[model samples]
Target chain A: MQVHVEVLNFYARQMRLLDALDVEGYAGTFTEDGVTDHAHRGERVEGRAALIAGAKLALPRYAGAAVRHWNDHYLIEEVDENTLAVSYCSLVTRTDADGNVTFEPTFAIEDVLVRLDGELYTRSRTIHRDRPAAAA
Target chain B: MQVHVEVLNFYARQMRLLDALDVEGYAGTFTEDGVTDHAHRGERVEGRAALIAGAKLALPRYAGAAVRHWNDHYLIEEVDENTLAVSYCSLVTRTDADGNVTFEPTFAIEDVLVRLDGELYTRSRTIHRDRPAAAA
Candidate 1:
């Protein structure tokens, strides 16, 4: 399979696990020492264990909501034989039990993915909240 | 490139043209006699000219908003050597100048895409608005 399709498919599966609140499953999509940097919040989470811990700690915020990460404009680059760099825009939505939908600020995400034993896993991710363009 | 990647890239470009309100450019992504069936509204628009005309009529709805269609869970089936059946869920968002986001009802869309001279184009599309699932 081509890197573009592979990377897109990887995100589709990984994000589903996260949106479903499957912390362990979601963390499994990453390497054992994966890192996630929330640039806008100045938080850096290192390792799958830490990732799961952080996810669990934030689970309560989604108590009665179905959360989805709607992504677009995926740009994928093959960094080398076994690594790929990918970036995309993400718009998050939370639909409550009563069918009311709310939005979190949109974000732009960059990820480095590596191939391990022919399977893809996220090595690192950096997220930046989107802001309006400054006046020129 | 594989069919999966080709289809995804086709959508990325097509959606961009659509969200930009470039009605003529958007219609050009379809075949000369392409058809769009709004199943929920019982409206059928046939051919590129009709598509452009219909889109122009709806342009005023997006007067001061940036419209976006965020799609996910693409299922692609090769119908034959040169045809593909694709389906996905779409969530529409309209962001006003001030960045307040509003949503249109979500939709499930099915499309038939055909490869002509090695490039893919939409042959037909059917859209259905999403609704709450009924309890058993």
Candidate 2:
């Protein structure tokens, strides 16, 4: 029970750091060799530095807009003794000054987090959007 | 241990049935009122009967082509005592007559499976592909 809460808190903390534009802190949640797979666009960023760089480029698209990622319906699978597979439907919303949606609101993310010592750090992250592909 | 194997087999059998064009058999894996959300296309098919209908419409697109669905990196989460959430990367490949690749290979799927009467059946399944959105 405590472990579950801690894990959920870890996820929330990562999102909160991003919301606060704490890129470095966000990147700290990953291991030194973490990987990010932007599956929605077929791009993979390897290593912690690359993952942080990718986030730096992507997270600021809504510079003047408010971006909120709502995640729920999480499935947490302990793939092995140490690795965890987590999935959730993340509704990412970007709103303007007038409260109008600035971008698509349906987003999802799946991740493989590994336990290092007693702490959990992400190993690989996959992203998705609930929209049609630009190309078939 | 037994439970894990059953869940994994559940996924494998569904793919096998699809590979064999056994829509009916594949549909049987779902509960009576299951929901399938193809997040890539922003479409949802509800209920076993409707799911079968949808599969019938989509599976034949590979009639003259060979389709292989490679699923791995599974993350399974037990949402509650009775409900389980499973996440995995499903790479689907379609080969032409000359055995050349025809479609994108990286596909991701997340599913909610429920335990009923000691057996597992999928309650909801969501799919996403890492690519730009096509004009809907």
Candidate 3:
């Protein structure tokens, strides 16, 4: 499979696990010692265990809604034979039981993916929340 | 150059054209005798000319807002050497100048695409508005 398609499919599966609140499954998409840097919040969580812990704590915020991450404008680069640098814009939506939908602020994300036995897994991810331009 | 990746890239470009309200440019993404069937509205437009005309008429509706179609769950099937059947769920949003966003009803769309001169173009599109399940 092509790298672009592989990367996209990886995200499709990873995001579904996340939105479904399958914390362990979501963490499985990353390397054992993967790092996630919340650049906007200046918080970095390292390793799959930490990822699972953080995700568990965040679960309550989505207790009664279906949260989805819609991503676009993917830019992927081959950093080496087995490494990829990827980035995209993400928009999140939460749909309640009544089917009303609400949005979260947009975000930009970058990641480093490495091939493990022909499958891709995230080695690192950095997320930046989108903000309006400051007045000059 | 996998089919799945190609189809996604095609949509990324095509949706941009539609959202940007580049009527002619958008129409150009279809074949000369393409067809658009708005199943929910019972409108079937045939040919590039008709497509362009219908789009132009709808342009006024998007005058002040930037409309975007966020699509998910793309399913692609190769029907022949140069033909593909594709389907996906689409979520539409319109962002106003003030940055507030509103959504249109969700839609499920199926499309037939043909490859001509190494590029893909829509030959037929059928769009169905998603509706709640009818009471039993």
Candidate 4:
């Protein structure tokens, strides 16, 4: 069973883009018609344009805040040759207005990804098992 | 490009168990060595026995709570023949101590799944965005 190295690299790149708050690179991770459903925010931004806009809106809110977020512990339930369902844990670190750094852990992000033109792009994502204390 | 149907079925069943809070059924989804990292709970339960135990501990706390959880909008990125990454969103319904039901939306979940022994299992996962708001 050979694991897909590209998928791992993709995830790693995503982490870097997000950590750096590079909205363009983050938006590039999706397809042109990609959709992002933010359950907690109660907003769904569809298409590359809107997705980019959302990223631009949110990325800077935390400016000057030290943050590190990573996810590991994965489960991939294949939906088909072109699709997959995955879930994992996410840990977040950030410095507050008081200059206190906080660590927050959350659970099981469920997502469905599709392969388009031999490139993997996100279609949708949902988050579960989030607690305030977990967010630290 | 043939999608793996069995994997989809497994994930669908797992989601059903979670929405229903069927502990036994939920525990049945993983292999004997399966583990769940409850990042929010800050606990990692390894193997089927521990997984079941953890579910048993948490299920009751959700009793009497109106629970609604659903997964949709799949974005799958194939890394190779045997590995994949995905992200998706979840919508949840909960009831408070006062019996008030609230629906909360969450962030997208990202994960990496590996196929082992002709079966797909979670290798790594990350929760990128998670937010919960008042019931709509």
lDDT for B90 (candidate 1): 92
Scoring each candidate complex against the real one, what DockQ results?
A: 0.13, 0.02, 0.09, 0.05
Interface RMSD of 4: 11.0
Best by lDDT: 1
Kindly report which residue stretches of model 2 are placed more than 4 angstroms away from their true locations once superposed. A1-117, A120-136, B1-3, B132-136
lDDT, candidate 1, A71-121, per-residue tens: 896877789999998877788889998999888766668999999999999
Question: Evaluated on chain B only, what is the TM-score of candidate 3?
Answer: 0.98
For model 3, residues A40-121, the per-residue Cα lDDT tens digits are 8899999999999999999999999999998986767899999999877677889999999987666668999999999999
Identify the superior model by lDDT, candidate 3 or candidate 4: 3
Candidate 1 per-residue lDDT over residues B26-127, each given as its tens digit: 999999999999999999999999999999898878786667788889999999999999999998877665657778999999999999999999999999
Provide TM-scores for the models: 0.63, 0.53, 0.63, 0.50
| Candidate 4 deviation (Cα RMSD) | 12.9
Q: Model 1 misses residue A36 by how many Å?
A: 14
Q: What digit string (tens of lDDT, one per residue) describes model 2 on residues A1-136? A: 4455556657766765654567789888888988888787889888878877777787646565455455677788889878889988775545444434433557788899998888888898888868776895
Q: Rank the candidates by lDDT, best first.
A: 1, 3, 2, 4
lDDT of 3 by residue, B40-130 (tens): 9999999999999998888778865667787889989899999999999998877655556677999999999999999999999999999
**Model 3 spans > 4 angstroms off:** A9-68, A73-89, A94-101, A105-136
Residues B70-121 of candidate 4: C-alpha lDDT, one tens digit per residue: 4556667788887767567765546443435455546466656667777666
Q: Per-model C-alpha lDDT, please?
A: 0.88, 0.73, 0.87, 0.62
Q: Sort by DockQ, best first.
A: 1, 3, 4, 2
iRMSD of all candidate structures: 4.3, 12.6, 5.8, 11.0
